[model samples]
Target: MKNVVITGTSRGIGFELAKMFAKNDCRVLALSRNTKPLDDFNHKNITTISVDLSLAEDIKKAVSFVNSNWKKVDILVNNAGKLINKPFTELTSEDFLEVYKINVFAVAELTKNLIPFLQKESHVVTVSSMGGIQGSMKFPGLAAYSSAKGAVITLSELLAEEYKEQQIAFNVLALGAVQTEMLEEAFPGYKAPLSATEMADYIYNFALTGNKFYNGKVLQVSSSTP
Candidate 1:
């Protein structure tokens, strides 16, 4: 069974993704700030960890878990993200930093620490947003959120190149609006075409096999104009 580590697993896509992988016989380490939801499910293949990705110590705890238990991670899904809906003029430096801490810096730090455990054919998938794509539709009040998402896409591309010789693959999925809590928070009452479970299903499959066909690439997983 492939060992998988998924972040933001308390709810939405991450929660569903965790169950999907576990049901498929993959060993999963599910991390989030709240572990209750996942812990209650208590699937034999799923292990829940309380992790606030913004903190270096929490990240270290995750790394230590992997080092002590799995030793190797077949898939690392950087699925955790933070979004702040504030107009540009109203946005603060701290706002930008808070978003980047979770969406960009945490991804870099976690992936960097996990590199040694990722061997040939290992895949690292970082979840991004359509708003992050340059020249794509830009939304107001998402300056920090969207920019941070874009930063992670570039970070993934660079890592894919740096690890090419090791046969490890890194890819980014720039997703459009999904009916997730995060989406609702950013755009209240804005109905999305896909559901969280639907998106998670797509991500689950892609994380498993997309590396064979592409690496250092960003796949825009959107069916809508937004």
Candidate 2:
């Protein structure tokens, strides 16, 4: 069975992604800050780990946990991220650094730490946002978050090119608003965001499709009219 490592598995898209992969008979290693109840689900193919990705030591522990046991990770989903919706001026320097630490630094470091263990033809999907692509007129009060995502996309592009010889795939899921707790907190009364499971389904398909034709690209998925 293919081995997949998914971060942010406590809830939202990450939770659903873990479930779907396990159901499809893949060996799933899920990481989150708090996964106390993960044992309750109790699937033999699933291993849930609780490690706060924002903390550098926690990130090291998580990567080492997977690397020691899983010989080759067939898929890696960098799904854990945070957003600070406060205005640019309102955000302290620490706030901006914390945001990047959780959203971008963690993802990049975790991937860097584990790339040696990734399979030759593996898929690496970084969950980003449309806010990462461009400035949003649909809303305001997220200058840092938007800019971080944009940086993530650029990183994905460079990694995609750098790893082309190995046939390893890298893709970014530029997500539109979704109905996660984060979204509810970021934009109250936001209309028509995709459900967590719906987004998970889209991501699951992309990861499982190892047809060699799909690699190093960004797939935009959403329920918005735009």
Candidate 3:
């Protein structure tokens, strides 16, 4: 079975993705700030690690766990994210740093620590937002979140090129409005057209087959305009 390490598995897309991976017989190393919810899975293939991606120091435990338990990783999904819905004028510099800490820096740090453990044909997929992609529909009150996601997209492109010699693939999934708690928090009562389960299914398949044909590509996924 392929060994997979996924972050933000406590809920929403990350939770669904973990279940899908474990159901498919992949050994999953799930990391989250609060892992109590992960106990509901009770799947033998799933192992939960509690770590707050926003804190750089907390990421060490995740790296150590992976290093001690798994020699190689077939897939690494940087799916954990934090959203701060505040207008640019009201947003503080700390707001930007907090969002980037989770959405961008954590991904970079985790990937750096696990690069050696990535299998030769490993797939690395980072979740981003449509608002981050240039030319995509933009949303109000998402300055910090959008900018951090934009950074993630660019980081993936660079990593894909830098690690091409290792035959490792890196890609970003620029998702549209998915029906998750994060979306609801950002939009209040707005109902999104997509569901977390739906996105998880798409990501699972993409992690397995997408790298064969695409690298350093940002895929815009959504049914709506945004």
Q: Name the candidate that leads on lDDT.
A: 1
What C-alpha lDDT do the candidate models reach, one value each? 0.96, 0.82, 0.91
lDDT for each residue of candidate 1 in 4-117, tens digit (9 for 90 to 100): 999999999999999999999999999999999988998999988898999999999999999999999999999999999998999999999999999999999999999999
Of the two candidates 1 and 3, the one with more favorable lDDT, higher being better, is: 1
Q: Which stretches of candidate 2 lie over 4 Å from their true place?
A: 135-138
TM-score of 3: 0.97
* Pairs of residues at least 3 apart in sequence or in different chains that clash in candidate 2: none
Q: How do all models score by TM-score?
A: 0.99, 0.93, 0.97
TM-score of 2: 0.93
The collision pairs in model 1 are: none
The alpha-carbon RMSD values of the candidates against the true structure, listed in the order shown, are 0.6, 1.8, 1.0
Error of 2 at 162 (Å): 1.0
2 or 3: which has the higher TM-score? 3
Number of clashes found in candidate 3? 0
